[model samples]
Target: MQKIIFYVVVLLCLVVTKIQAQETFEQRAKVIAENIENITREEKKILKDKVDVINTQLENKSITREEADKMKIEAATFHAKRIEERVAFEESRLNTLIKEKVDGKIQEASADSVTSKRVSIIEVRYRKGNGNGKRKEVIEKRTTSQLVLAGGVNNLVTGGAVANSKFRYWGSHFYEFGLTFNTRIMKNNNLLHAKYGMSLVYNNLRAVDNQYFVKNNDQTELVTSSTWLSESRLRNIQLIFPAHLEFDFTPKKVNEKGETRFRTHRSGRIGIGGYIGANLQTRQFLEYQRDGFEVEEKQKSNFNTNGFVYGLSAYVGYRSTSLYLKYDLNPLFKNNSADQNNISLGLRFDLN
Candidate 1:
């Protein structure tokens, strides 16, 4: 309530000031034009010097073609910004002048004109207000929204190394990818509300370890050989949903220059979730060897060999996504008393 009253008082003061500042449109336009001319003259002089250096450097081989071109581009951009600033200054001056002139005219005219004008040209008026505050507020809101969207991508592209191995380890052919999406459900000057997430992924896992080659070479002479390489493959599909408790730190607001900016929000998140799914496995492609005459041979399973499947999951990552490693507590082959399991290190893209 106090803040609101303070703002209202400030607005009243602005209106009073605006009314008193009234002057002829022609007079204000002349002042604006003069200021614009002065700005142009100064900028033009600086631009001339800059262009001279640009040309000289381009001709002299002091800088490479790429470097010179880059310099030119920079100068061009500076020139453009200078032009925009001059234009803004002129426009602001003109607006103040025009508002003063029009207001004075309306005040001097019959009372009916003032009423009519307020209903039409001036939809709102406070003792100190001229609508500028409201306009500025609207612009600020739009700018903040734009900044949020532009900066939102920083949340999606995240990665972490597999640093440990428990029932889970890192450094395998294990990998995961997903499309994450977030929507701001709520936001305020002090807080923001949002429920955003991701859906679906092409999860994959594969690894092969063999010791036959080592033993085979120990006996073979000139023609080095191994017991033959045995291979095992584990593959699965996973889907996880995460809900995050995020605390935002830094805040940002657009400057008078209409540029969106941000400071670090160094936030922390505690996410809880589970992965519900299974992986298809190929236990082994069998083959045989003999010392006597060779017999008939059988081929192996293509696309998919093993039909073993199981589910396992773990928790990791921050708000938007996390790195995860899950292991299968189940065996891959039936009746095959081979102790085998799946160890997968992957990432869970958050869809909360």
Candidate 2:
């Protein structure tokens, strides 16, 4: 009778331990599920934020609706894939824990035939895709559009005897700014692209000598100023439309659509092309110290300069930063006694 009582006590203890182990497994599995869900929720928020940006871009006309939609689709697909992978990992972990618990229960109750059977139960119900289709698919056409702003420095250089003359470039005074659209030309070949836009270009030349430009019929003569001048600057503003065929050498990144997008101009790029536009305004700016006060003077005139201008422009560099050079095929002044062409070199920024 005592032996039977001892076996009864042992059996009762094993049953209690198995019940406690099952409860612990359930709690752990619940915690794991919650953690996985939290991480997925954070990732979804990030992807949604990107979609919001794309929508804003569309509303602003910075990007086309098709482009914005494409971006949204890509973001959704990417987010879904990430969630699936993470859930799969967590599910595997939970399965291992449950399996260990069951195996332990079986071992502890091995003396009884009723409680020693293996328990195998796996529930897998996962939602897939962006809910747009039965099978996952990515967009085939990949395109991007954005508003670009660029600004850089400018200077002038000449050829022949004038090149030998002492000339000064006002480093701080010369610059150009443009609002443009940089787009890929071919869908597959992202390396080739076209950039076209409107720019407000300001070119300032500071002569070393106390000289000013004088227009005589068709002649633009560089003559000395009658009054002593503290500063003499020639300011020319051109409303230009520039176009370039660019080659991007930087590594490309594959998007969700399996299409490649060129790295930014800062990454490495080269552009070769030209521009044709009209000179909007030209004036001579003079600053002097009269008595003890500073005096400023501006003389607005054509100075026999051409109304229309065309130039050859090229740039090479990495990322959005580049070295820019431009040369006018025609003279700055039409049919002048002295033939002085306009050539400028500067740095450029391309918002890609």
- Find the candidate with the highest TM-score and give its number: 2
Across 36-139, the per-residue lDDT of candidate 2 in tens digits comes to 54656666688879988998899999999889988888887777667647755865675455446436642322223212322211111224587767755343
Count the clashes in each prediction.
13, 6
Q: Per-candidate TM vs. native? A: 0.29, 0.55
- lDDT scores for all predictions? 0.34, 0.60
- Candidate 1 runs further than 4 Å off: 1-171, 189-227, 239-270, 275-352
lDDT of 2: 0.60
What TM-score does prediction 1 earn?
0.29
